[model samples]
Target chain A: MNAQFKKGVLDLCVLAQLAKGDKYGYELTETISQEMTVATGTLYLLLRRLNEEGYFETYLVETPGGPARKYYRLTPKGLAYTQSLKDEWITFIDQVNRLIR
Target chain B: MNAQFKKGVLDLCVLAQLAKGDKYGYELTETISQEMTVATGTLYLLLRRLNEEGYFETYLVETPGGPARKYYRLTPKGLAYTQSLKDEWITFIDQVNRLIR
Candidate 1:
């Protein structure tokens, strides 16, 4: 798969995963990486950006013998953003499908 | 639409447009822009890059009373590139759809 293309949809994938349920940074990485190629560096950067943008809120959960895990939960705004990105994906793909066909 | 996202697919879109037939630079841009947002600057740059990568060939077609228009036609390589991009698009979208669903 094209890396740029994959990067383009990573945001959507991350948001969608969070939509399923909140997950810690590594957990989110694990879920998305399972489906496709994810540059962990890019994923973490995206997570921070999304959280900064108010699309997500993060909470730290501490483990007994380890550092706290930062979990991401989609805020209402993030849900709305995800829907918008999904809609754009649909419309964009539809046009490409028609052209390629 | 996210500019980066749209950009990621623009190479595919441009090649798909030429797959039908040849087109001049502005002509190709117009055809794609009609359906979705296309940054002309980006499209031209993509055109040049794809051509350099051997995905397209260009020729000048003189007009009756205007400057010659450079047209783009798909080469064998361009056709193959288009197919690969189409395949990538399909696979990428499938993953995204499944995730977002």
Candidate 2:
């Protein structure tokens, strides 16, 4: 896996994970990392950036005998953006598939 | 399309194009731009970078009543690399499709 390729789609992966439901940082990281080669640092930075950009909102929930866990919920804008990215990615890959195969 | 996404796959696209036959910079750029949002500047920069990285070799071809056009041909390394990228892309997209849909 290329480093740039991982960086390119990491945001989309995070958004797609949240699209399923609100998830805390560790859950999101573990889910995506399981499927791809993503660094914890890169995932956290993307989360912070998207958070600052208003694509996601965070809420803290208390856990038993543990610190509060902050979960990320996708905003309306995030949902729309994810849809667009998904559409583009599908189209792009389809075109490449035709060309390469 | 996201700019970073474009940046990430541009190399694969160019190498795939050259895998078919040799092409000058403008021809490659036009072909890819028809399907996606890629700037001329970015395409040229990518070409230069790949050339410097030894994935591509360039040669000048004379055009009748015009200046010579520099065409790009894929190196053995480029072919192998393109194959790897293609494999990774297919696998990654398949995983994402399963998760998202």
Candidate 3:
């Protein structure tokens, strides 16, 4: 897949995944990477930016064998942003499909 | 639609448009912008880049009362690039749809 195209939708993927359930940094990166070839480094940077933007809030959860895990949860703003982007995504793909087909 | 998402597909959009038929700069922008909100200025810049990258070839078509219009047609490279990107587009969107849905 095109790198730029993947970058465009990366935020949505992260947001939607969190909407399903909260996941820690490594866990979130793993889930997204399973679906696409995104670099964990890139995902970390994006996660920081999204958290700073108030779209996501992070909390620390203690693990039995390791240090606390930093998990991300969607804020209200994030949910609203995801919904709007999801709607736009449908329309955008439909328009491109029309022209390409 | 997200501007970044639009930017990611803009190259494919232009290439796909040329694959349909030859079009001058203004005419191509007009056609694409009708389906989606793209700035003509941005389209012109992309046309120049694609032409420079050898994906597009240009010709001059003289009009009766107006200046000769510079037209763009998909080159062999452009066609191949479009096909590859189109294939990638299908898979990419499918992956994203799976995650979001």
Candidate 4:
């Protein structure tokens, strides 16, 4: 995948994943990495950035006999942002597919 | 559409268009603008950046009784880059569709 191209949509992908439910850094990375190549370091940075931007809020959850994990959840702002990105992506692919096909 | 998402894919879109043949700035913008929102200024900047990156080369075409139009064509490097981007896009979309749907 083009690095530049991935840079464009990675945020939306991560946000969409979080919108489904809270996820730890590793879980989020694993889910998206299943669909595409993504660096765990890069994802962590994005999570931090989104948190600072108020799109996500993180909380630590304790698990029995395991370390507490920081899970990410979308804020109202994050949900709204994700919805807009999804709309844009759908419209974009629709147009591109029409043209290319 | 999400500006960032568009930013990721617009270069690939433009490169794909050029790989088909040469195109003027207006023509390129008009072709892509049909499918997505892009600022003329932004496209121009992208053109310049791609050119500098050796992904595109420009030439002036003399049109009868009109100003010379600047047309863009893909260099060998540009062609290779476009092919790679196309492959990545196809895979990315395929994965994303599966995940999102």
- What lDDT is reached at residue A16 by model 2? 82
lDDT of 2 by residue, A1-101 (tens): 22233245667778888899999998887887666656688778889999999999999999998799999999999999888877766776766666566
lDDT tens digits, residue span B1-101, model 3? 22233246877788888888998999878877767877778888989988899998889999999899999988898999888878777877877887888
Off by over 4 Å in 1: A1-7, B1-7
Stretches of candidate 4 exceeding 4 Å from the true structure: A1-7, A63-66, A99-101, B1-7, B52-57, B64-66
Residue by residue across B2-54, what tens digits does model 2's lDDT show?
22332466677888889999999989878886666667898899999889989
Could you tell me which 10 consecutive residues in candidate 4 chain A have the lowest summed lDDT?
A1-10
Ranking by TM-score: 1, 3, 2, 4
Count of backbone clashes, every candidate in sequence: 0, 0, 0, 0
- Give every prediction's interface RMSD: 5.8, 6.0, 5.7, 6.0
For A1-101, candidate 1 gives per-residue lDDT tens digits of 22233246778888888888998888877776666766678778988888889999888898998889998989999999888877777776777777667
**TM-score for chain A, candidates 1 onward in order:** 0.86, 0.86, 0.87, 0.84
lDDT of 3: 0.80
Model-by-model lDDT, in order? Answer: 0.78, 0.78, 0.80, 0.78
- Classify candidate 4 by CAPRI docking class: acceptable
Measured with C-alpha atoms, the lDDT of residue B63 in candidate 1 is 96
Mind giving the per-residue lDDT tens digits that candidate 1 earns over B10-97?
7777888888999998898788767766667877898888888898778999999988999998989889878877777777777778
Candidate with the greatest TM-score versus the true structure? 1
Give fnat, all candidates.
Answer: 0.41, 0.19, 0.43, 0.24
Off by over 4 Å in 2: A1-7, B1-7
